[model samples]
Target: MSTSVALAAALAGFALGFSMIVAIGAQNTFVLRQGIRREHVLAVVAICALSDVVLISLSIAGTGFVLGALPWLMTVVRVAGALFLGGYGVLAARRALRREADALSVSGAEPDAASRRRSLLAAIGTCLAVTWLNPHVYLDIAIVGSLANSHGDARWLFGAGIAAASVLWFTTLGFGARMLAPVFARPLAWRILDALIAVLMLTLAVLVLLPLFTGSGS
Candidate 1:
């Protein structure tokens, strides 16, 4: 690929990845919590970053064609994803409403090592589900990847650029946000964060389900 083309592809991929990920959602909330607790932060970030890598790789490799061919399958995934998001949103809202100050504190400051380990595992699992189980992620990566591949540039180079962008974006989001852990450690701050997350998750779920109920977007 021409240097100009490669540069353009990289910039485009970076913009797309950052735009999609830099939002309040389950994955971001979990990462933020882990960062505040200062437990297994790197592992959580790694899991989030690697999940994006695998998904983006599949998208670039043309596996997204399967999603295009199986329309019914995507519908099922969409419904499941919506339900998951809604349930998570409710939980977040409940936490905010309950206002359990102690529960919101940074877990495992000293003697609660076992609790910290479990929390780390739970965070990793949640991040994986939030990243992998959402049908929209597949649509974004695959549909976008397919279109980029069709643009007559070197396919491999374009795919590489996109994948690199994913890595960069997630790494920054997961780790860079650690700097704000002290601020979020405050109970009021967590309450606000959880409330915002609830709103974002519910909004996304409604957006996903509206098309299904109306049958207008299909």
Candidate 2:
């Protein structure tokens, strides 16, 4: 591939990856909440971006397609993912009830009964779950993997570009969230955000489960 062709392929990969991930979804919502809370921001970002890195790389190498042949794998993921997402949604709804919970949630402050401690490790684990458990994630890998493979020998360049997009987008989302801190500083904003997160997670869980019930989109 000529230099121009390589760069073009990389840019195509970057645009495709960025566009796919920029949409509103459970993972994005969780990232936004972590960013606003200023809790475990780096870990959240790292987990999300790194998960995408693995998925994208698998896609580029064409391993992602092989996973699609196993319907049982998706079935297992669907059940587990629904349970996790439903539980998280319940927790978020509980947090929403405690309107007094501080947005900043400073340490040593009187803790609200409905509020749970948000630890870095917990955040990392949650991000990992949200990224990995979703059946939609594999579909993204399968789709993008084909796109990258289309670049033929230049697929490495394409993969690198997709990885770069993941890094840049998540970094901006996790860090750029601070810019909205002033707005989210209010307790009501926190409640609204948590409520939205709850709904988003729950809805995604239902969508994942719907396939099992209706046998569509599997």
Candidate 3:
């Protein structure tokens, strides 16, 4: 009976985590961009998945109480996230409008060693910022942690399931994106993708700040 309960809790956690994360959001958008570009895909995916693990663990450990005690923290994160998303959206829009012929290639361009190193570092920094600065991540962590705790002894199992989901989803998104390289080989396809990503990011930025302006809890 105990083992069955644990399994059930684990499944529930995975379902909830996957559902929440599968939605189109700023973090996921960034990951998809990196994947499509084939730019440090492994590092980007690792940062995203590991960041989820740390946030969920902290939430389960009751660190979320800190945010509750300090309401201003959420506000800071909200504003910063909105700014970041808005900036990225503008950049994407510019890319979409550029006249230069740019398209994906399976054999992608190879930069010099120093250039590759610098680009890798930049990608890592952006990945960390994107993962950490999102207000939605904290909200999701809070929900997941609270639900996990409801399972009593099965809480750890539940968290493990969530961790598994994070790893699986990010892995699939990062690596599976390569399959689309053929379609993105067309410059028009690249433009369309960048345009869509720009709209998504800008919309998410407004959504992140909506609660603040309306004085409603998200």
Q: If scored against the real structure, what TM-score would every candidate get?
A: 0.84, 0.90, 0.95
Clashes in model 1: which pairs?
Answer: none
Ranking by lDDT: 3, 2, 1
Best by TM-score: 3
Instruction: By TM-score, rank the candidates, best first.
Output: 3, 2, 1
Candidate 1 lDDT at 189 equals: 83
Candidate 1 regions with alpha-carbon error over 4 angstroms: 1-4, 102-113, 151-153
Model 3: per-residue Cα lDDT at residue 87: 89
Clash count, predicted structure 1: 0
TM-score preference between candidates 1 and 3, better one: 3
lDDT measured at residue 217 in model 3 versus the true structure, 0 to 100: 46
- Each prediction's whole-model lDDT (CA): 0.73, 0.83, 0.86
Give the per-residue lDDT digits (tens) of candidate 2, residues 1-218: 79999999899889988888899887888898888778778888988998988888888887766877876777887888899899999998999988465666545675454443446557878899889987788878788878888889888888888889999999999988988888876888888888888898899789889988886755
Where does candidate 3 clash, by residue pair? none
Error of 2 at 22 (Å): 0.1
Model 2 residue runs over 4 Å out of place are 105-118
Predicted structure with the largest lDDT when compared to the true one: 3
Task: List model 1 lDDT by residue over 22-69, tens digit each.
Answer: 766667777776666566778888887778777776777777887777
